[model samples]
Every structure is written in C-alpha cells, then in structure tokens.
Target: MDKRILVELTTEIVSAHASVNEMSREELLDEIQDVFRKLNALVGVEG
Candidate 1:
C-alpha cells in the first residue's frame, strides 16, 4: 500500500471515531472492524 493512502485512511478513521456521539459499545466495535477490513484491503490482504 502507498504511504499516502495509509495516512489518509488513518486520518479518516480517526475523524469518523471522533465524530461519533452516543454510540453503543457494539456499534463502535463494528465500526472499528469495518475500518480494519478497509485498511487490510488497501494493503492487499486476502479476506
């Protein structure tokens, strides 16, 4: 993966988490998992 793409993805993830309000634990966990999956894909990791 490109360094720029990784940096952008990390920034987006941080922004998304910071923007959330009043979310349940499960919902937050799911969002984190989704972000991880996206990052993995960006790095060419097989599912």
Candidate 2:
C-alpha cells in the first residue's frame, strides 16, 4: 500500500525480468512471491 514499496517492488521485478511478455504468468508469480518474502523480511515480516 505504500508508494515507496510499490516503486521499489516494481523496480526490482522489472530489473530482474525485463519484460512480462518474456515471462510466463506462473513464473512471474513465483518471482513476485519471492520478492515479497524478501521485502517482508526486511520489514521484520510482521504482517
């Protein structure tokens, strides 16, 4: 919900994978889930 978080996440996702056109939906979902987990840990994984 935070703008900074959104931007950081988008930047990470885009930088890692370039274009969504090149990644399958499930593959992208997996990458997103991984990034979210890492970000959550950085925030102390509280909620």
Candidate 3:
C-alpha cells in the first residue's frame, strides 16, 4: 500500500477504537477485524 493510504487507514482504525469505547467487546473485535481485512486487501494480502 502507498504510505499515504496506510497512514490514513491507521488513523481511521485509531479513531474508531478511540471513539467506540461504549461498544460491546464482541462488536469492537468485529470492527477491528473488518479494518484489518480492508488493510490486507489494500496491501494485496489474501486473508
């Protein structure tokens, strides 16, 4: 992935984690997993 895009994704993940403190543990895990899948696709990684 391009550096800029990677940085943007990182920022997005951080923001999501920081802002969704009220979410249940399961929901937060799902959200993090979704972000990882997206980042993997962006980097051409099969997951």
lDDT of 2 by residue, 1-47 (tens): 55467548856775667563577778677777677767666664323
Q: What is the Cα-based lDDT of residue 33 in candidate 1?
A: 67
Model 2, C-alpha of 41: deviation from truth (Å): 0.7
Worst 10 residues of 2 by lDDT: 38-47
Q: Is candidate 2 or candidate 3 better by TM-score?
A: 2
Candidates sorted by TM-score, descending order?
Answer: 2, 3, 1
Per-candidate Cα lDDT values, in order, are: 0.67, 0.65, 0.67
Candidate 1 matches the true fold with a TM-score of: 0.50
Badly placed stretches (over 4 Å) of model 2 are 1-16, 45-47
Residue 7 miss distance in model 2 (angstroms): 8.4
The digit string of per-residue lDDT tens for model 3 on 16-45 reads 776957777787677666776677676854
Q: State the local distance difference test value for candidate 3.
A: 0.67
lDDT of 1: 0.67
Overlapping backbone residue pairs in candidate 3 total 0
